[model samples]
Every structure is written in structure tokens, then in C-alpha cells.
Target: MSEVTVTVRGEHETRVAPERATIRLSVRAEGSERSPVVEHAMRLTEPVRDSITARKESGVIVDWTSTRLSVRAERPWNNEGKRLAPIYYASIDLTATFIDASDLSIWVSDVSPWDGVEVGSVSWHLTPETNARLEREVASEAVGVAVARARAYATALGLHDVEPVEIADAGLIAPTASAPPAGMAKFRGMVQESGDMTGASMAYEPDAIVITATVEARFVAR
Candidate 1:
């Protein structure tokens, strides 16, 4: 009899509370010339940057990185609907890491109200060491899931035994959008406003971060 093979996929998921918080902010300026816009953006961001720098002294801003500056010219479609005299725009983006979970609200409140500044959603994440450990654990569990399914298939087909012939791995799947925990909805929603807001009434609950692993195994009937 010819050999037969079946491919089965297994998935494993785990939830963990994030250990730290992250916030991204953008500083932008527009003008008729590149130099003027670049200067304006830098000046506008000074106050916000100063606040974070001050926090860094006390460990609130654990880590931060600045992205390269970008400048582009406005597309011209005549004066009626678009560009009048070729406006230029310059902007800088920065991301900050806050290790103290309790300081999330304070950090957001400090940065969101600056002029010409835009705030991104506050996201929570695990440390590098923690993430590595979780990944290993889930991967092993997923393989076990695959093995069980293969054995069940072998029994139904009346095959003597089943053995894995080929195994393919799938990488981790992360959430596309941040999911705010219950009671923190207002805190997250406050990001849309350009003014300082308070969320003292709400309690912070680290949203459970979901990690998923999938594996495909080809099993041969013996």
C-alpha cells in the first residue's frame, strides 16, 4: 500500500499582564521653507522634551529614542484647493518607555497637552526576558497539541502508528490594536483630546496581552 500523510495545525495561547507602558509623541511644524519649518518644530517640542528630561532624572522616563527628522513639500494642485506657494513640513517622532506602571497616567497627562504635539495610544508590554520565556513555553505546548491530533487520526484510519515526518513553525501573533482594560477606557479615550485631563477615578488594570503560537506537522501512517 502507498504511504499516506496528513498535515495538522495546532494553536496555543496565553495571557499575561504587561510589565511596562509605552507612549509615542510627534512634534510637527509647517511653513513655506524647509529651514523655517524645521526650526519651528524643534522649538515647539522643547517644553515637552524638557518635561521628559526632568522625569528621566527621577527614573520616570526609563528610556527614550528619537526618530530621524522628516521634511516634505506640499503637492501643488493650484491655489484654489491645495498649495499656495509650496509649503514645507518638518516633524520628529519620539517614543518613551515608562517602567513604573503607576506613572502611566502622569506621563500621558504631562505630554498630551503640548502645542503641535500628537499623542499615540498608550501601550503596555513585557520585558525582553519575560517575553522570551513565554515564547518557549507556548511553542512546546503547541507541539504537544499537534502530536495528540496526529495520534487520534492514526487510530481512526486503522494505521499501526503515526510519526511526524515534517514540522513547520509559525511565528507569534500580536494584537494589531491596543485593548484597554476595564475601567481604563476613559484614560485611553483621553488620548484623543489635546488638553490635559484627569482619570483619577479609574483604576489601572494591565490589559491581558495575548500570545499565540501555531505549528503545522505532517504525520505519516505506518
Candidate 2:
């Protein structure tokens, strides 16, 4: 009989194969003598850096970075309760980004067994352009969901058309404090893993990226 305010939340999610992968690894050297640790570390790290540079030139690697050498000394007690001489450890951390997941797997397999090389986890993601496009589309779909639900509620109440009053990201509409503007998509979720993109020689495959969007809206229904 009269206009009523309707508030609802909308959500949408989509899964897509990852378009990029970043490999993290470190080159480490430890020796009882302190003077030679840094040299050994540098020597061990050079090949890895060269490989990444070559890949970058050839367009296989999108980007790469290596940290300065880190050196530390530690002394430990022996089994007989006697303290052993100080041991010096040096390490360099490097990360390389690849546009192809198969190439990442190949690079990881090639470097993982090298002396002083420790391969870390791989991060899977979509390019910024791709993510932005998907996020906008997903946000639009979420708005549509909100509209459809509002209409359903009005129809159930023997009402006619519904008009939107306000819309904001999740929590902004009802929260007390001023919340930061959440992106159209909050996070890129890694939901599924498949080896189809990588060949048999590859060490492993990357997980799929999930784009999710949520929104809250208020409407007037009659």
C-alpha cells in the first residue's frame, strides 16, 4: 500500500586460468670462514641472474628483481657442550615474473636442483588489464543481481516497480566508520589447480584465479 525501503547484498564470482606466474627463490652460501661467504654467494647467484636476464630479453620473463647480498654470522654449541666457531651465511633473494605458466614451471625445474638454490612458492595472477576488465564486468553482474532480488521481494509483497536509492561496496552502506573504498573485486582467489597448461616435463601447474565482487544497495519499492 505504501513505499518501503529494501536493502540487499549482491555477490558474483568467476574463475579463469592464470595468465602470469612469479617465481621466488634464494641463493645461499654458508662457510666457517667469513671472508669467502659473500664471494661464494655471489658466484652461486650469478647464473640464476643471467638466466632471468636472458629470459627478460627474449620476452619470456616480464620482470625480475634481485636483492643485495645478506650476510650473518652465528655460533652454535657442539654436542659435547662446547661452542663451535662462528659460521657465516650469505644469501640473495630473487623474484622473476613470467607471462606463461608453462615457462615458469620449466624455469623452476631447471633451477631448483642447482647448488645453493632454494625455490620458493609461485604466485599466480592475471595481468592488471585483464583483472580490471573482469572486475568491472563482475561488479555490473552483482548490481544486476541486487536489482533482480529487489524486484522479487517487491513482487512477493504485491508491489509494482522498484527504484534504486543508493549503492555502495559491501559494508559501506551499513557500517558506522568511514571505510576505505573496496575494489570492484576484493581479491583474486586461487581456487583450482590444473596441469593441462603445463607439459609432462613441468614440475607442476598453477591454480586458477577467481574474481569475486560484492555490493550492497538500498531501493524504494511500492
Best by TM-score: 2
TM-score, every prediction: 0.66, 0.88
Model 1's C-alpha root-mean-square deviation from the true structure amounts to: 8.1
Question: Who wins the lDDT comparison?
Answer: 2
In candidate 2, residue 212 scores what lDDT?
78
- Give, for candidate 2, the lowest lDDT window spanning 10 residues: 191-200
lDDT of 2 at 59: 100
lDDT for model 2: 0.82
**What are the clashing pairs of model 2?**
none
In model 1, what are the clashing residue pairs, if there are any? none
Regions more than 4 Å wrong, model 2: 175-182, 188-201
Q: What is the TM-score (0 to 1) of candidate 2?
A: 0.88
lDDT of 1 by residue, 1-222 (tens): 345686776667788777777777788999878898898998987887887777788888788877878889986687567656788888888878888766766667655666778776567777888877877777777778888988887777777678788866632222223322111111111122223333322224466777767776788976
lDDT per residue for candidate 2 within 2-85, as digits (tens), equals: 988999877787889888788788899999997799999999999999999999999999989999999999999999999899
